[model samples]
Target: MSMPPVKKIVTWLLVIFLLYAIFTSPSDAANIVGSAWDVIANGVANIGRFFDSLIARS
Candidate 1:
């Protein structure tokens, strides 16, 4: 609410924004992979749920 505290908050916010911009630049890259693993994880979860339902009904 006071002037000094408001100025400090604005300065800190500016510093954080600059740091984030430096990290996420296009020069960095990733080794890409297919979505097969995602699909497999989902499939296993579905199978577990199916068995759980069967046991619940018995």
Candidate 2:
């Protein structure tokens, strides 16, 4: 049997993604924000560590 057309497959995937996001896992969206903040925090912390290492070298 032939597979569904690409447009139909994309639409169905989007529909499923939206349904899952809206109904079953709303907080999952918030984790994206949390992940961004975590990355920011780690970047700042790494910069601080690098500066501290420079001071130690001096």
Candidate 3:
């Protein structure tokens, strides 16, 4: 199946913006990535805790 034109355009735009940001200010880009990683990790940890609690209750 083919992706919609609008979705493709938006994806390309985001890619271009990310590349621009990375090249223009690498440190800032690194910080952004780090922050995003922390958020994702924390979210996963929270989900794991939720499941653990559910299992413990059973």
Candidate 4:
């Protein structure tokens, strides 16, 4: 199966924009990535805590 043309175009545009952002302002990019990582990590931690509480109740 192949991706639709519009989806492919949007993906390419996003890639180009990311590259431009990285090259134009690396510090801002780093901060953005760090923030994204923190969000993901906190989400995973919350999920883990939820399961822990579930198991503790059993």
Off by over 4 Å in 1: 1-34
How accurate locally, in lDDT, is each candidate?
A: 0.73, 0.88, 1.00, 1.00
RMSD of each: 8.7, 7.2, 1.2, 0.6
List model 3 lDDT by residue over 1-58, tens digit each: 9999999999999999999999999999999999999999999999999999999999
* C-alpha lDDT of candidate 4 relative to the true structure: 1.00
Task: Quote the lDDT for 13 in model 2.
Answer: 96
Candidate 4 weakest lDDT stretch, 10 residues: 1-10
Best by TM-score: 4
The window of 10 residues in a row where model 1 has the poorest summed lDDT is 25-34
Candidate 2 Cα misplacement greater than 4 A, ranges: 1-25
Error of 4 at 20 (Å): 0.2
What C-alpha lDDT, on a 0 to 100 scale, does residue 12 get in candidate 1?
93
Off by over 4 Å in 4: none
| Ranked by lDDT, top first | 4, 3, 2, 1
Predicted candidate 4 versus true structure: per-residue lDDT over 1-58, tens digit per residue: 9999999999999999999999999999999999999999999999999999999999
Positional deviation of 4 in candidate 2, in angstroms?
Answer: 41
Over the full model, what C-alpha lDDT does candidate 2 score relative to the true structure?
A: 0.88
